[model samples]
Target: MRIKALALAATSALLLTACSDSPSDTDIQAALQPRLEGASCVTAAMFKSFPVTLGSTFSTGVSSGNAPAFDALTDAGLLAKSDKTYSLTDPGRAAYVEQASGFCYSQGYEIAKIKDISPNTGPMGAAVDKSWIVTVDIRQKPIAAWAKTPAIEKLARNPENLSDVPKTYHVTVGRVKGEQGLKLIDPRFSIMRGVSVSQGY
Candidate 1:
């Protein structure tokens, strides 16, 4: 009778362990998809600065360097040009981020695929509280209409020859077990490079 009781207890423990297993890749991906999809993607240039001088000369000549892009934006009704100087319209101001010194063009990113999932280990090489590092391929969604113009698209493309803008970005996401079961945690979406214009510009 003692032996039978021990066996039953062991079986119950095994069942409990199995039930508390970490979420699978599929489950993690499903939870992470919406989060990634809601993250906005911006451009490296275009609206490189905010609060454009209302009366300053925004030379559209070759000397301006970004004349084509500026003209495209002006035509898109984002910029109001009086003679040569440029100022942000209501719509433009709505898109502008003075702190970022640029505008968000693309709506968000989409999960292309889950690349890998590995146990997040501590310095001692032991798993850290049921945590994992999830790597995924994410693609930027379609950009705003104002940003689709050739000049604007050209300005946004990292490599001039690259047909797609931010086609696939390899991002690392964190997942950990919580009281509410497994939950997706901090995702390093800032790994995306060339997505910000220089403050000097």
Candidate 2:
């Protein structure tokens, strides 16, 4: 019914730092497209439990019970399970924590930071019969202007009616099993439909 976060553009400064190469503007937008489409879905998956099997394999992790968030790590032997407890095979709790902080959805949104992830019956479960809710800090342009697309200024958050910049928006990601998936639920854009800085910030 309304244009959501994924409907817009994103590639917060955090994503740029992920690589040493400087991606073209097109590359950045292309990278963020999937995230815009399923922002909510992955957001939901990101918070869901990393499957009991996966959870017990790592002291910390985040992902949909349905989605294999750490299949690569598992293959790498970075994680293992002994009984019901999950432990990192690598040394140092700090290293484990650092690895755990990293996550990415099927879409392109990178999990910059995870404040908390809890298991729950969420919209994503409507079709899969299982799902998990996650609260995460999604890194996106502080304002649409940063993306060089000012048309959706309404969808971007601007505090104090000031300049655009990089910002971290806390969001809840989930799904209800429809045509599109993972619609982001953000309070900031509730009124974006009818308001814009051009209209007079």
Candidate 3:
């Protein structure tokens, strides 16, 4: 996946500013491991509507639905659902690490760096700013191999097989006023795989 230009510049600036008392590389990596692993958490709305497993089925019209994704996310301490909205918790940051780890192991490579992008308010309260970011780099060859189309395609595909009827992925999982719950999300956006970035990007 491509990093945003402004984000890249800002990230560089932040790293430059933080360079004075940065953690040792080993400690940094250790600190970031869990976040990367839990990056695949899904919203409650996604869990309710999509076919997450071979035979799992969920009702579309109802507000309450149980999902394996949520269970996994909650167990991993990566996701939490209140009302209907689904958001990542502290443990979910390992998503980046999980991606990097998979790439390294599958392609025979090394890790170079890990970048963390946290959640925060942006300039003038305009856009949502990435609170923190950890970037991890690996051996060029391994990264390239892992980034190839086949690997990406495999990761991109949904883990569950839905009915022959096609379904879209959506991120809505909450009330209208705020991050309340699943009802907040509009119905039009209905893609099945909510973990696009975590799964492939």
Candidate 4:
């Protein structure tokens, strides 16, 4: 009788352990999908807005060096150049972000793979607030229409000009266990423009 009781107890413990195992990759990926899909990556500085003087030459380090890009924007109907000065068209204004001070080219991203998930432990080795550091590979979705322009693609190809071009980025994501199961916390990821020594040159 005693042996049977011990066996039953052990079986129950094993069941509980299995039930309490960390969430699977599918679950983690599902949690990340919505966040990734909703996010947009933009050029770091190529589309940044600058003060324009109507009828005067739109002269700036950025404009002077990347005249082709400016011309492309003009061709795309996003900019209007009159008397050598450039101004944003209605569409350009719509794409502009005041906070970023740049035109937005919304690009989608996805979780390529979940590399690792390790417990976030405190100094004493106890799990910190039941959190884990999830390492993942993030890759861009299909290229957006605006970014597919030949000039834009050329700009992106130049590593010095557009650092934020679509590419696989390895990042650490934060995950915490809550009442509702595993919840992703900080997943700060974005493509940004590369800083050029001579503006767009």
lDDT of 1: 0.54
Q: Sorted on lDDT, highest at the top, how do the candidates line up?
A: 4, 1, 3, 2
TM-scores of all predicted structures: 0.51, 0.24, 0.20, 0.51
Summarize candidate 2's per-residue lDDT along 17-105 as a digit string, tens digits.
53323223333333234454421111122323332333321444421342232332333343455543344554212223232332221
RMSD of 2: 24.5
Q: What is the lDDT of residue 152 in candidate 4?
A: 54
lDDT of each: 0.54, 0.33, 0.33, 0.55
Model 2, residue pairs in steric clash: 6-36, 40-182, 41-182, 44-173, 47-134, 56-86, 123-175
- Residue pairs that clash (backbone atoms under 3 angstroms), model 4: 44-193
Candidate 4: C-alpha RMSD after superposition: 6.3
Q: Which TM-score value belongs to model 1?
A: 0.51
The candidate, 1 or 3, that scores higher on lDDT is 1
lDDT of 1 by residue, 1-201 (tens): 999999999999997775556456667766566665542434434455643433213532123544555566677667887654678898788776665555656555666666666665633222225665666665666656665556555555453221234344333334433444355555454434324332222
Please provide, for model 4 over 1-201, each residue's C-alpha lDDT reduced to its tens digit, 9 standing for 90 to 100. 999999999999998785466557886777666666643433345455644432213544354545665666667566788755678888777766766645555545666677776655533222324555667776656544655566555545453233233345433333333445455555465443322222344
Q: Candidate 3's error at 120, in angstroms?
A: 14
- 1 or 2: which has the higher TM-score? 1
